[model samples]
Target: MEALLIAIKARILELAPEFLQFPLGHLLSITPVISVFAGIFALTTWIERKGLGRIQNRLGPNRVGPVGILQPVADGLKMIFKEDVVPRSADKIVHFLAPILLVIPTMLAFSVIPYGNRLVPIDLDAGILFFFAIGGSAELIVFMAGWSSRNKYAMLGAMRAIAQMISYEVPLILSSIVVIMMAGSLSLVDIVAVQTGGFWNWHVATPWGFVGFLLFLTAALAESNRSPFDIPEAESEIIAGHMTEYSGFKYALFFLAEYLGLFAMTGLAITLFLGGFHAPFPFLNWVPAPLWFFGKFAILVALFIWIRGTLPRLRMDQLMGLAWKFMIPMSLITFAAGATWHYAGKGLLAWILCTPMLLGSYVYLGTALTKGQKVSKRVYRFAD
Candidate 1:
């Protein structure tokens, strides 16, 4: 299957005139990735709305298309036709440019991830570094959106978003660094290559890897401005924060950039810890590699939606406290644990040694952090 796709791509490039082939080759590689993720973005909106409605005991958007499956189309049309409103007092150029800037970096970050067997787009030696570098630009764009708007609420929201990102970004990068330490390459493709043999060889199978995966997932949620970590745009408080002033397609672009970033980060997680496109069992290798990658991607996306519905937004103080007091410390511990696992020969001795220290640190952190907080049993009052 992989060879067939490669052959088809090579054949197309061969047919193109020499001067156009360079650009044409890139177009072929890039177009499919954009198309696939754009489709996923639309589908995820429907799934999230329906899933959240089900969680809340309601039917969501049933009138748009068969059970509201075409709602994303309807929403897109509305955004496109809606009036693009700019505040009279705002810096119009930056306000207009911020969303476009946000989309660019998010899209560029997608180039390095390996989606299937031999399917990396750019394959840079420092691919993972490139991804993070592109991702960090969103922070500045967020502040740009807020500052340009000249609205107090928007500025406040942007500030919160920046702080939230800086706080969580530490543990987020640290968590992935553990994988780099083990995999010994900044190239994401190489990271995926190291875990290819079987499920047991997958990084998440080890003690530090398991801890690292959890830490990465939590930090990714925050980095993407997902809920409980969504305090920056908490509508109840700051009214969309950095995005409060955006309207029409500009507003939609921010959302599109956000979902794309989510997809990119989630894809990275799958590559780093879930063994990329590798099948769980040797027998299942017959399944297409792309299928394995997307299957895992879907599960993680659903998990994100489920969490959004289930968890309430944290208070600002609590959010910062969690990052400083817990996440960073835990991530550092996981890094140490990964080192221990490496030195202990990745044998039974490594598992026996690292597991205890990691688990023990987790228990101690939880205990010590919660020691001063008073807890009382919930008393529910029935309303008639």
Candidate 2:
């Protein structure tokens, strides 16, 4: 990022002469760009609720406006006026700061997600690395919220929350490493550009690319704390986990942080696996780039909602086991396979389709046998 700053400064200075030449509209146009994004995020807030509502077969936010399009707006108003309540037993200072802590990292993470052609807020050379580094910031804030509450349930929730997030973060970074290796560049724009041609060019279809997509998605699911991986907030177990003591806008801060995190994760996935802002159709890249970015992103947002409705949360032990047992071993095996394939100089199509079958057969067969043994034990119990 520093190396690029030399040209960056020169370009900005070059534009400064023009900015002085025209006062109001020229400099002010940048304001609308920021507003557009903020609006987009706000719309996404609505989309998640309305979409999740439809999937779960119920009304989400109908009373506020027609089709509930203005529900987020109404909800925002309610939170703003609502009384701020902090537990009497809680530490005063940290409780005051925790909401800000939760939202700041989420805001930072979005800055690295490129929107479309040359539309990124800031494009660093180490974009993907910067992403993970910022992504981990939430765990810290989450733990703080749990600890500062000074509630027993809150403390236990914080520990569980930390454990779940930390475990999933490993596979999340490793899975993304596969993309860095394939694209040979960590910049999110460069990664998307490599998939510019069409659906086939998208990395998710290639061998290492496909495995990377699966691994990345699975890890991202955990990272976002979605169902089937949401051990932290299980009502049956942890009872809203780290945020149990929060209320009013304070609770809303954590709530918005979660949706923002989900929004960012979907955008990252689109950028990495689904070809970012490129049109799914090969020739469609010729169309304006923003359409593709929004189109793909909206589809992914729906998928995330669908997942929330369709899946059940994993047990805490099961969640832990998945990271250490399933995700870790699978990530290692996939990494090695990709490395070996690269070194062997095998054709991309051939290796991706064939390698997982040939290379992983032993492991697959052993896993099958173990499943069979479990099934037999269940049958025996039934018979007895």
Candidate 3:
């Protein structure tokens, strides 16, 4: 299948006119990724709305088309026609540039993710480093958006974004380092390649890998500003956070950058722990690799949407405590477990040693953290 794609690409390049060849080749390579994500971004809005509607016992955006499939189209039209408003007190130049900065880092981070076998856009030796370095710029963009808006609420939200992103980034990178250690490579393709096999061979099925994956997912939710970690943009508290002053298409661009960031992060998660595009069973190899990759990706996306629908936002203090006191320590221990497993030749004895260590840490931390918090059992009351 990879050979077929290569042949097709080469044939298309051959058919192009001389002047357009190089540019056309580059365009062909990048166009599909961009177009697919754009379409997915549109579809994701509808999916989240409808999923949340079902959770909340309401109909969401059903008027636009069948099951609200065309809602994104209507949304795009509305944003295009609406007035782009700027506050008189705002820094116009920085405000104009903020969304572009936000979206660029999100898109660039995807360049290093392995979508399938031999399907990376640009394979760099330091791809993992490149992903995190580009991703870190998102905090600066958030600050830019908030400061340029010149709103107190926006500024506060920006501060929260910085705090949350920086705190979680520690565990995020640490958890991923376990995978890097196990794979013995910093390249994303190499990471995925090491995990390829039957379902059990996947990284997440291992003792330390499972723990790392959970930590990674927790930190990822915080980093992407998804709920219940979405305190930065809590609507009840701060209108739209950094986006309070943005109107029309600019507001839409913020939303686009957000979902694009979600996609990129989820892709990275799949690459690192879920075996990228590898089939679960050897016999399932008949299915295309990209399909396998996206199938896993869709499950994780839905999981995020489900979490948003079900969980309430965390308090700022609680959020920081969770990151520093819980996730960071757990991530460090998981790295140690990975090291032990690697040295112990990943034998049954290694599993026996690490499993207890991981479980003990989780139980102890969870108990200690929730010690003073209220605990209640829900009593359901149906409408009469």
Candidate 4:
């Protein structure tokens, strides 16, 4: 405990050396990061709503400010002023506790996410594992919320939540292993540093790299409850699931946790495979590092949004099957493929040797996609 305290003190001191002189100068020094992130988080929420609203051919929150510019601010006030309710049958303590519990870890998970070279607050050596460990909190607190809600729907939602997360978490971890193996360290900084030169150095360039990328992408979607994987809280079936009885600010807290989770997961994807905070292409590395990192981050987030707009939620059995039968097995195959290529000694020969397998996988996936079109056509014809 003493050692841990000392380490924490060191981190705090590192965050602001001016504290020694001005007594609270570090707060000012770190103010930009906190305020900027807070603003970004709030703004992103509004952006998502507006965009989603646009997709549905409606104006979203346009009354809050011009074009709903102050919409988040209004929403914030609404949540803050509203009376939080505990369901009559709920476990009051757990119900009250769960939303806060869910939100904190979602925010804290960003600590080790390397924003840029030297931009991180504390880039732990075990960043990848830290990310994995922290993410588990979501599953736990969500269960707490669901179980505490004292509704059968909430209970079912919580069950689905637990099952869904556990299903995807395996592939998430396995996919990350491919990265840890490639970078030879669990640190996000080290991962980025290894890919310093250009696009070719990035993991997505390899056979296992492609496999790992797709695995991480799918698992991340599952982890975040985005679209196809959003079975736990599917409105049509479960009626908000774990958060069924939460009201006002408590509901907002759940909403914030989700968006923050999306942000962190996208950042994680950037760090692990896309060369966190790196420029998109080799030639663009000449641009400032922060721009490069954030540029890539933005692209991934946009991809996530695009997907949410495009896909329908998966059925529970479909969700479970995809994880167990597909994601897990594919991730393992990817990790092995990555390791085997590295063992063959990291060069043109390694790339060449992996080419056939890569081609085969691509062909198989392509054929599968085509088969879906054929099946869909038959289904439509039969319906007609």
- All candidates' lDDT scores? 0.93, 0.75, 0.91, 0.80
- Candidates in order: C-alpha RMSD to true structure: 1.7, 5.6, 2.8, 5.3
Model 4, position 243, has a per-residue lDDT of: 77
The stretch of ten residues in a row with the least summed lDDT in candidate 2 is: 24-33
Clashing pairs in 3: none
Clash list (residue pairs), candidate 4: 277-293
Provide the lowest-lDDT 10-residue window in model 1.
375-384
Off by over 4 Å in 3: 17-22, 376-384
Could you tell me which residue pairs clash in candidate 1? none
Error of 2 at 12 (Å): 12
- Which prediction has more favorable lDDT, 2 or 3? 3
**Alpha-carbon TM-score of each model against the true structure:** 0.97, 0.83, 0.95, 0.86
- Per-residue CA lDDT of model 2 for 290-376, tens digit only, reads 677878877776776688778888778767877877776666766666676667665765676546653475376347434633444
Candidate 1 lDDT, 53-134, residue by residue in tens: 9999998779987999999999999999999989999999999999999999989988999988888789999999999999
Which portions of model 1 miss their true places by more than 4 Å? 377-384
Cα misplacement distance, residue 76 of candidate 4 (Å): 2.1
Which tens-of-lDDT digit does each residue in 310-376 have in candidate 3?
A: 9999999999999988998999999989998888788898899889989999999888877898869
Ranking by lDDT: 1, 3, 4, 2
